[model samples]
Target: MTVLILGGTSEAVALDQLLADQAPEIRAVVSLAGHTSDPKPLNLPVRVGGFGGIEGLRHYLIENRVVAVVDATHPFAAIMPFHAEAACKAENVPLIAIRRESWKPRPGDRWRSVPDISAAVETLGKPPRRVFLTVGRLELPAFADAPQHHYLVRVIEPIGDRLPLNGVKVIQQRGPFEADEEEDLMRREGIEILVSKNSGGPATVGKLTAARRLGLPVIMVERPPKPDVATVDHIDQVLPWLVAQGIFVTERGV
Candidate 1:
């Protein structure tokens, strides 16, 4: 039997390794959205680019004889989850969403949670303050409203001349970032405020730790709605789901 993993996040990468090691019999094929120019390759066989949409995904599941799907995309990549559920249902394939735990406000974490990007823009307010914008390459147009603030944007790809904010610096990098490094970057930049989506993973969660330590006010954009599906927080949970579906003979020591 085969399993499809919709991957772009670190959890997805980790899950790929776990499945390869634990469930050797099940052929696991990972699908990437191909939004980024270069995505870190996984050890397991991977296919880049989209599945065309819901119809394409459904067809892929049926054609591939997929036994299960694990939606391990970003928390804010909302639309994909709905499509995963639909495709799985149509193909009679079991689906599990590998959703990471959301970042909660820890002690000294001054968070101003906003409904969406527009609200986050409003919460950022006016009059120039150095800002650390960790929201990535999504809707940067919203930040153009608060252009007065000196913005330091972190993205996986180069934003180039297309960034909407006037005074801005872009860091083309990915993470597994050290908390000390994050704190130092925030300190050296003279950042007074932090703007980020609640991506909720250890890779980018260092920013939250830095914000709390620095006592900076964080304008956190809340996550979009995810489809109501069987969701698991950790990659290990996927092993059990595969076993439950009779895809795997038994769970190996993980």
Candidate 2:
């Protein structure tokens, strides 16, 4: 009689709050990947770290009696959604993914879309450029191959000895940054090129807007393939879907 929420995004937090306020009888648990050391606290029951793999996840759904699962992880996440789909199927539990829409280029956006991170490095070319890197801490090492470019890396977690390049500057901060501030940073750093993942959320999208205003070329890394499952873009839609699934039954008569 529990709903397992695979959480890491802002959408997950909103959904958790919504359920807590509206569906008081339902037992909802938020599971985090533990990417950030000090993740924002949520009111619902929270579980941290991975469930090993697919077999481990399958065991969790069975043991916890998880009737449904919501995949609200980050778009850049490549593996977890597939694993959730498989595990939920194995357990005969319903699964839904909150697939945020990818950002489309506007009139002034100078974008070069590539399939993955490696291709992005290849796109950077041999000549050194002042690169604004926002693809997160996990994939920072990939830039090691293209060490000639100076990288301005911003991450939520401290990137200690992760990228051993000579001209790399690390800034640890959380986002939903203003476009004016983003523009100022880019101009001050003399950024020639911007490298970012098409993560498709407002929290970090100010970089793209700033880039567009400053007329900087962006090497956008596209999201990896995720398993096709029941999907929606917003958090508000989740509770209705759960109710429709009969996971949260309503009592009749007065």
Number of the top TM-score candidate: 2
RMSD (Cα, Å) of model 1:
1.9
Top model number, lDDT: 2
**Regions more than 4 Å wrong, model 1:** 251-254
lDDT of 2: 0.92
TM-score of each: 0.94, 0.97
Q: Per-residue lDDT tens digits of candidate 2, residues 8-76? A: 999998898888888878999999999889888897999999998999999999999999999999998
